[model samples]
Target: MVVHSISRYLLIILSLFLFSLVIIECKSIKFSTSLSPKSLDLKIEKLTHLHFYLQAIIGGDHPSEVKVAGPNTSFIAFGTLEVEDDNLTVSPDVNSMTIGRAQGILASADQNELAYLNVLIFEFTKGVYANSTLSLLGRNQIDVPNREIPIVGGSGVFRLSRGFAITSRIRFIPNSSVVLVFGCYVLHY
Candidate 1:
């Protein structure tokens, strides 16, 4: 029994000593004030797979659907938004971003509703880019059905984003200037 007790006591002491060493090493780790609260080591690499495919309907002269506000010359225009994923084809599913709306005070008609200053905040589904409304501006849309627009800025996940949008008119109705199908591809970082 004496030998047993001695061995047990030695084992207990060894464990206690190891525990103390662990505690000491843990306390020795000093947090430096110079270190950023956010991990400075956090690497920011562009997510190449991140892409935006949207179909925008520019509201023309529709009594209820399209309302014209602000100055008579520079009217506020609101339109619908539909966003898709990798499939460039605009076949929207339940998971697809849909029923989105975009509104912006139109610039002078002299600018043909295509002005760098004509900005529209487009809202859509999901949390990623939902916090901040993505902003868009018309770049070039003269006689060409294909127009390149600018993504001036964004909010939420897309905050401070800068990119361009290439839009091709899939359909255009000049009768009431009320309908048009545009294929918009927007890429940003």
Candidate 2:
């Protein structure tokens, strides 16, 4: 009789446990801004892998704001990035292949070292005002050939983007001016 009673108790416990599990599963927390219990699913997608070159002209007279704070200066630079199959120099004009532009600011301790935030705006027929913005925090040492920086967040077309940008010095003109080429690859949703 004792053994039978114990088996009945065990069965009841098992049934109660299962009931509790169902209740918990039904009450799953929804990740959303709404007060309702409805859940919001996240969307996963890939943006274009924009391969372009920034023919940026640095050190005044261009469309950039540069404030020299002794050896470490701060600046805001803007330039054109032409789209091409390979990393070759191109004309900075409104052409059929003209994809976008590189517009941003940079804080530098030296000529080759900087922290920058750049926005790349695509001027394609379909994309129109689509843009990819990036935050680059790194040291572009004079000896280092290139610096790969992070493309953080963005707006318009490039929403919630995360990726990397590469900057390589193409030319250093007279009077501390420079021409830089920036290549960006990003993923957005």
Q: Cα RMSD to native, each candidate?
A: 15.5, 11.3
In order, the Cα lDDT scores of the candidates are: 0.47, 0.49
CA deviation > 4 Å runs, candidate 2: 1-43, 59-65, 71-99, 110-139
Best by TM-score: 2
Please give, for residues 1-189, the per-residue lDDT of candidate 2 as tens digits.
999999999999999999999999888966755543223233566765655444444445553334433332213222212221121233422233544544443433343333333333323222443343444444344335687777766666566667777767666664444455666687775
* The 10-residue segment with the lowest total lDDT in model 2: 79-88
Q: Per-residue lDDT of 120-154 in model 1, one digit per residue for the tens? A: 66665544544445677764444456566777776
> How far off is residue 30 in model 1, in Å?
32
Off by over 4 Å in 1: 1-99, 109-117, 138-142, 174-189
Task: Give candidate 1's total backbone clashes.
Answer: 0
Model 1, position 104: C-alpha lDDT score:
56
Compared to the true structure, candidate 1 yields what TM-score? 0.46
Clashing pairs in 2: none
Model 2 C-alpha RMSD to native? 11.3
TM-score of each: 0.46, 0.49
